[model samples]
Target: ESNRIESINQSIQKKQGVAGCHYFSESVISPNFNVRITLNPDRERKCSRAVLRLAQQFPGDAGAMAPFFLNYLLIAPGESFFMAANEPHAYVAGEIIECMACSDNVVRAGLTPKFKDVNNLVDMLTYSMGGPNIDGGAYSMDNADVIRYSPPCPEFEVMILTVEPGKQSTFKNPGVPVIMIILEGSGAFDGKLCRPGRSYYWPANTDDLIFTVDSSKRGALKVAMAHKNLHLDRPTAINREDFGGASSSNHLNYPTSPRLPYMGLGGGSTPVNEDRRILSVGSKDYAEQGLPSL
Candidate 1:
């Protein structure tokens, strides 16, 4: 965790200009070892919770998990541990999809990024380790290349559309924002082409989202998407909304994740990218707001 947190510190403090304090001391490194990554301001910072990633109250406190409406992070085959809002994840080797509230309030117990407040993170994280995996029960799409993976989170859900070469999947969902992360082969979000490492955020109230693979590559064009369940008018209808609204009639009421195992490589694993260092980007604001920043 120290190494992981060190990487994040480098990125935020050194790489990016976000973190104001210079946390390059040995005490910060030693105490943060093996702790999950979750950093929030001590109420002295200036920011709104709607736009912030409040890591202070993480998985430990389910009541505090709502404000994070950050990006749907995609950790490729060799990508390092995702930071900020996303936490308690499940990704083992292959590509995976992760979507959560927009805020960067991540609650970590173990994984990467060693924060000084491990006790605080553990106190805020969700005690019950949900499932072992990300989205569960992915069905075959019209195109064999695409498969959708959905996790069972009420506030947000993820859909991984794995597309093969020359194949495309059309999603007609309106009013909700969608984030796409290209994992495997090269593809496009809506119409813009995205490489493996690129991440794109589609604005809310959109009516359509289309993903396509070049069809030249042999692997599937893995696309991970995160969006609000606007199609679901009621709580009981969650199991019935799938593959955009056009195909809602055939939506399967299958129970998603929160029951699967937390899949991912164990600690002391090999770090993937050397050029892109990880850093503790701090927590998103956790203050009160009026509008829903989904």
Candidate 2:
């Protein structure tokens, strides 16, 4: 692996206008070698092909390249992947609906012009080898209509909810703010219209939110919801069984909680219960009102 990396670096350095030893360390090496390559379809395609060719030539050395050494996964619509922190990965193609933590502490290794924190990335990785483990980090809820993608962290949880046409689903709030996006068909969220290309945010402690797909819609109404896991006071047996047992720090034992609901396309209605208060970005006096931001 080191030999292949060294050879690739040397070749990059010898290129007339390239200034860096690494292929993706400088823009001149391939003009589109920087981080921008991840966003440009043409550049990404060329880079993927180049990486595949290199991998084929030196199969033994390909492991060291980490993420970029592998070919892209052609993820079809409705299918998705979970990427945790410190995991080396890159998105090569297609549109995706990403639901992640609010923080932006990403550590990039290559395929971008962004700062490559090589040492930090190396120190943070789990170093597990082999192809992508699709089943390693995923778990499903008892309700077949919902699937939870729980990463080994207590701060966030992602759930995919499917409401069949003419059917409905109810979610009890987990007492945390939530962000949701509609992925397929049309539905009524808490009696409000929801459709593709739209997102909604619901404040913490909102009452049970109901969702019903329009019977006229051709397929089920699919939505991706993300929120913090605030109800981890106890761990379940299933949580302990995941990832070959819970981590020493208990990061993997995220206790199941009632899923939260995010507002959809239409004006949010105030909870009829006079005691319950909901705050949103659209609140009339949001700027002047003194409410803790989620």
Candidate 3:
């Protein structure tokens, strides 16, 4: 969790910017809120009751009293929630397909057994009173049975495809790489059977990837994918140095992780560096704002 929190700290401190999304597979209660009140000696105990009962006010197990002063979000099935870099959010319940930039710069304040960095999480949060409107994030395509999630950050984009029986979905790579996974139903991709829970990765500009569901099947094929944002007008050629730097911390999510610029993803693990370096950049401000003149 330190590594996760460190990345978030770096982002909030302007060392790097990171963003992420959660595509719910099942209903759940998660963290996606901001402190609703000013903190004082007794105020923390008298804030909202949601997080108190949901996490605290019971025993030492639920979590902490901090969430009570923050706004909570309820994400339903088929909902994809986007969280920008440096935002304070926590997962409460339910299942979700979470995808973020290839970075673990996160800060975990409370809500889990993992080590909690109260000061860091508190200092990192924006403390904005309200959050995104229901329509703030997410959209779908009219022609194709697909929903695409394009968050505000520059790292990545996501797409959900629902391919009905006998129908096929064709994906043409304009120029970036793509990582895909089968979420439900059986289908054919690149002439091979694609089953649920299986993952597939295709380097940038690979032969047009195609998938189809047979007419005999009763269920439609559902697939979730993430790739470099296709909306940018940048050149196709990728410069390794553009990756900024490497991550010294790694977890199960991507395991060896984003050190792609330094080593092939699956290559032998490299020793973790204590002082990972990157070019200087300002903190992420979703409001199109930057730091006030210093």
Candidate number with greatest lDDT: 3
The best-first sequence of candidates by TM-score reads: 3, 2, 1
**Model 3 lDDT tens row, 24-71:** 111222333223223323333332344345333323422333333223
Poorly placed runs, candidate 3 (over 4 Å): 1-58, 61-63, 135-143, 232-294
Between candidates 1 and 2, the lDDT winner: 2
- In the range 18-67, model 1's lDDT, one tens digit per residue, is 11111224344333321312343333112223122332322222212222
Candidate 2 per-residue C-alpha lDDT over 1-294 given as tens digits, one digit per residue, 9 for 90 to 100: 985575455334323111122333322333332333365354344434444443343332212132232223333333333343434444432345555555536655443434555555445543322222132122345456776655444666567788999898887776888888887788898868988878999888888788998788898887877787432342111221133321122001111222211111111111111111111111011111110000
Query: Is candidate 1 or 2 superior in TM-score?
Result: 2
Name the best candidate (by TM-score).
3
List where candidate 2 sits over 4 angstroms from the true fold: 1-84, 113-130, 136-142, 230-294
Q: Give me the displacement of residue 247 in model 3, in angstroms.
A: 39
lDDT of each: 0.34, 0.43, 0.44
Q: For candidate 2, report its TM-score.
A: 0.53
TM-score of 1: 0.41
Q: Provide the clashing-pair count of each candidate structure.
A: 44, 4, 15
Which model, 2 or 3, shows the larger lDDT? 3
